[model samples]
Target: MVLAGRLRVYLIALWIVGSGSNIVNAAGPVAETSTATIVENVSYQNITALPWREADHRFNYGPQSLQFGGLWLPESASADNPAPLVIFVHGGCWLSAYDIRHSYPLSTALADSGFAVWSIEYRRSGDPGGGWPGSLEDVIAGISHIRQLQDFSVDLERVVLTGHSAGGHLALLAAQHNDLPSLDAVVGLAAITDISEYALGDNGCQKAAAGFMGGSSLQAPAAYEQAQISVDKLPSTVSLLHGEQDSIVPLTQSDGFEHHRLPRAGHFDWLHPQTPAYRLLINRLEHYLPEHTP
Candidate 1:
């Protein structure tokens, strides 16, 4: 665990310094408290301690080569006892370089907690027919593919959509587009809510944002308008969680939307089961779970 943690820290440091240069961009004029001290005071643990437990099944949603594929984490379930489901979308700055593999630990942990998990992979900005409407379309299709799992003992009415980073953006967008009446709630971990603001900023994901949307908000006004979240269109309650010390995607990105801010937490802290942020997430999710009459 210690070795893995060190490796993760090394990798993250390299990523920020190497590929993710805009990770430290200023949070614009957003009102933020003094949490900068926490950045230096905090000690990060390697959150990827758990090995990747292979999914029970893999399902393909569309005909396109990049259009399909989802990892299913099925906990014990019976016809009389159907497990609730969580459709998880991963974040990689909306790029094809990042995929759903990084989220295995979270998916495994959630499944261990008794909720069936579907960690999905979709076409990203680099792939052909990816980005903009294509990526968004894949998210919607992936969530809807839950219906094909009728053979599995799943309670569709207790479904939840949880996403991280770019995936969080897709999750919120999917909730607006998909036809899931049973979507009890949407949980976004360090989610990107405002695309136009993000594109205009100098964040690590700024360039990818433009790429994902097909161009600048001005160049692709229709795409930005279509993908941006409209609170009025949300089908379920939205719960956002962001780390106070997150420099990659600042806490301000979640501004305008109420979110649970974790002190001394960083971007990937929510994915670590041992972190307080993850516990907070589980607690929030408990309210939406089906009650048992013991």
Candidate 2:
């Protein structure tokens, strides 16, 4: 829970009001559903400004030909060095409008803090390029790819999955089944955590979630189920960080999510950035991950 993390939630909340609500129609030929064709040699816009010390690629389940890239922060040789891996997924409400470029800063920050980082970029929504389960597939692929690489410097055993907004939603959705090699922890930063509540009206994000899910919950029950970020899907030891004032994806989303979650599933830490609660939450997180190392 960094100071910037709190600021991010607050800022996105303000934009939720002004953002227009409209579903984007398909743009080009729809890419194969569940069939991910990796765009090879594709360079990510290195927005981190941090010197890229080292990077590599591994296709978890998609085309190995695609040249996807990610950074690797190796642990210190000393025994005291922390052994943890953090994978960051970017948020764009499942649209191509946003990409991994925006997450570089956060990845860099995590790397500087001694945690190995993987900032992923997946095919986004709006037809042609990507949509629906495609984004979810890519996320699973990215994590699996990392796991398949035997020589990856980061400790796969202590891995933590993290995301902001839509990425947060995906992170939560990913946790539902305990399917992928079993992540140690899941963290959502002001994530789009609840689908049913968000789609009730016409805020920009609500509209995006509705369209991304392919219609109202009633019309697309299956799609809604697939995209739902309910607490039941979350891991037993998940960590969620959000500003109480977040408007884009209201804080209530997190509240509503926990409302239905089984007590044994997990407990959420809802921190307000405007108060001392933010620092306390981060302190708890720092210890929480280490304390709950499974």
Candidate 3:
């Protein structure tokens, strides 16, 4: 058992070092500097610099009039072809305070990279009928609503799902549902995979888990079970990217899954287009795309 445990730790170290090397190579001149220094030099202000699409269409997917919306950004689409689609979900601890607006930068960046982006805004804990099944339901509904975009130049077969934090958790969970369309790949950035473990911890987001689920795991075992993403149920080629220095969501949240760990990156680093973490994320996205795609 000790030997096995030691091997696991060794493998994790190798993975972290390998990921660091890739980040360094992708970061150019910054590769010569220390990881901490490179991270320190990254500008946080750039996240909000790019303006999102001025018009985002809102749709009511459910009966409560609790509408969900998608901000669509298509990279140039010709009459003969449609761009691939990427559905982005934002994270705000499953609360209304944190909406889809925070994801605008990342969505716009993806759009600029020659892809169509559908940034989703769903109901959250503070909203009436929000929480547990409601938030999850909204995500499923939003994705399903993609079928309604037939008129738009979107390649449905190449659709990918990407999310961060709470949204990451939702994206991962949504990928597991057989009812949803088969996804080409699912990318989670600092996602919360273990609902039970998260609710039991003392982290700042811990209490929000209870609020989102409506009770403790012990109090609502069935709900927690439904919300949790089992390792075996993950999409075949799921890519999880997380930061070693993230304080909001612990790295252990992605314990059982194969994930790439950035040396000194934080929770919000994934959202910034200028960070190495974002570069690694784009590489991962490109890896799953068809080779013929530009």
Candidate 4:
């Protein structure tokens, strides 16, 4: 096993901590169980800046340099006692500007909670052979390679596929394919489900849909059609997690699909270990792939 490129260590539990002191007032109606105060500790810059542990191991699914992924096993994990696996995809509007490193905090948090996380690094829009089918293909290869993953200890039966933002879109696209092995669940954190509509938005991220897709929906109708998700074709177990306060990708993106929203959370709150949104996500994951105790 290769040593982590960054510091590799265990993370502490991030349960609900602040009660009255840290609570921030959300403008609109709060969700049923919103612990909004947790948003204080989570933001794109905040999460990426946190002192997080790197993956425990690294492997390449393809020859491309960007085709590699990192694995983070839980403390109790071993070949004799395999931990469940979570395949992670990070989102940066499908741009090369954002890399897999930003998602380490989330992976580290999941590993600490007893799941083995494999965060994939695929080529992005600005990179050669990246964007559209290439980006999606890399993600598919990363997930499919797990069937042949060796040395690392993981429960294949309990595997889940998940991604954030653009990554979520790819996760859903990949899971819907017939070639992939059966998965326990697929979760999207603030995923951009409707790409055609997203491409028209004025926000910088929304406009990036064109960059990743090669053009506006009008210019590349086929790519847009292929990239847009069909909710009916989704897996038996799927969850769309959106943050109401998310300005990067609007909560409306989750419309027409069954989803859960965090009232006080911004997009990055879902990745921050200390946030209530993150806690709820871990709870949802447990429900989908409960720790196998024999």
Candidate 1 lDDT (Cα, whole model)?
Answer: 0.72
lDDT of 2 at 161: 80
lDDT of 3: 0.71
**Model 2 residue 266 CA deviation in Å:** 24
Task: Output the worst ten-in-a-row residue range by lDDT, candidate 3.
Answer: 1-10
**Candidate 3 off by > 4 Å:** 1-51, 55-60, 63-66, 291-294
Which candidate do you rate higher for TM-score, 3 or 4?
Answer: 4
Error of 2 at 71 (Å): 2.5
Candidate 4, superposed: residue stretches over 4 Å from native: 1-37
Scored by TM-score, the top model is 4
Residue range 112-150, candidate 2, lDDT tens digits: 445667777776666454667777777777766656644
Candidate 3 TM-score over all chains jointly: 0.80
- The deviation in Å at residue 243 for candidate 1 is 1.0
Residues 48-97 of candidate 1: C-alpha lDDT, one tens digit per residue: 33333557788888887766555454446678787788888888788886
Which residue pairs in model 2 clash with each other? 13-247, 13-248, 40-66, 40-67, 41-67, 60-145
After aligning candidate 1 to the native by TM-score, how far in Å is the CA of 73 from where it should be?
3.9
lDDT of each: 0.72, 0.55, 0.71, 0.80
Q: After superposition, how far is residue 117 of candidate 3 from its true place, in Å?
A: 0.8
Error of 4 at 168 (Å): 0.4
